[model samples]
Target: MSRLYGDPIEVWTREGEPIQFVWRDRLYAVRRIIDHWVVAREWWKVDDDDPGERRFWRVEASPGQRLGTYELRFDTTGAGWLLVRAWEC
Candidate 1:
């Protein structure tokens, strides 16, 4: 596993797969999706009005220079996207 951080970001998707994202003023293109899953809501931790299910993806990406693996997520209840974690190998 990689070191985790809660970094909110803007993402662009194609046919339900994330294709790119903007982080720290730079844009990175997702080269491939390694894995993906849906996280059910934690009802005990959040109110009913809070975001529902969350969809997560682990992907290999590049910012035009260096390659890295990143974990990104989308909230189904309309809270938008987030870059949850990242690492280079």
Candidate 2:
């Protein structure tokens, strides 16, 4: 089962890919990127000059123990990084 958690987190990226992140004062290293996609809801309503896309990355990560799946988002409208969902693996 997956759980939702729209919490803001600090993410470190390398070459446009997340390599590590800090959430709840715990550091989790991204072992692999399970999947990635971009969402632009109501694209027809968005202004041409506005950045409305939200990039999502589903990663397999761990903090030195059991690995877990985490979904992170980077909103182009300046909403920043958000830890969207999680699943224990």
Candidate 3:
């Protein structure tokens, strides 16, 4: 199928499980849909007594609002989207 994209956003499964929504399309099968996602958590960091911080994720299949992934994060260099973080399962 062709690729799809959207603002990497958060979603919840019908069972209330948290899943990331990274894409949107008119495709549907059984378990999985036509959306990309990221199963992410908190990543804290510190250096030279510069305090500490964590990074959030908005992972996707493409980079922008197209057919791909987009990971918007926050950390030392701020946050933005990426072309692809890892391959979708």
Model 3, span 1-89: residue lDDT tens: 32334243333334432233332432211232344334333346434544434343433333333443233333333333322233343
How high is the CA lDDT of each candidate model?
0.89, 0.93, 0.34
TM-score ranking, best first = 2, 1, 3
Candidate 1 residue runs with Cα over 4 Å from true position: 43-51
CA lDDT for candidate 2: 0.93
Supply the global lDDT for candidate 1. Answer: 0.89
Instruction: List pairs with backbone clashes in candidate 3.
Output: 60-69, 60-70, 61-68, 61-69, 62-68, 62-69
Model 3 CA lDDT for position 81: 31
Q: Which candidate is the best by TM-score?
A: 2
TM-score of each: 0.84, 0.91, 0.24
Error of 1 at 74 (Å): 0.6
What is the per-residue lDDT of model 2 for residues 13-87, given as tens digits with 9 covering 90 to 100?
A: 999899999989999999999999999958566877884888999999998898999999998888699999999
Name model 2 segments beyond 4 Å from true.
none
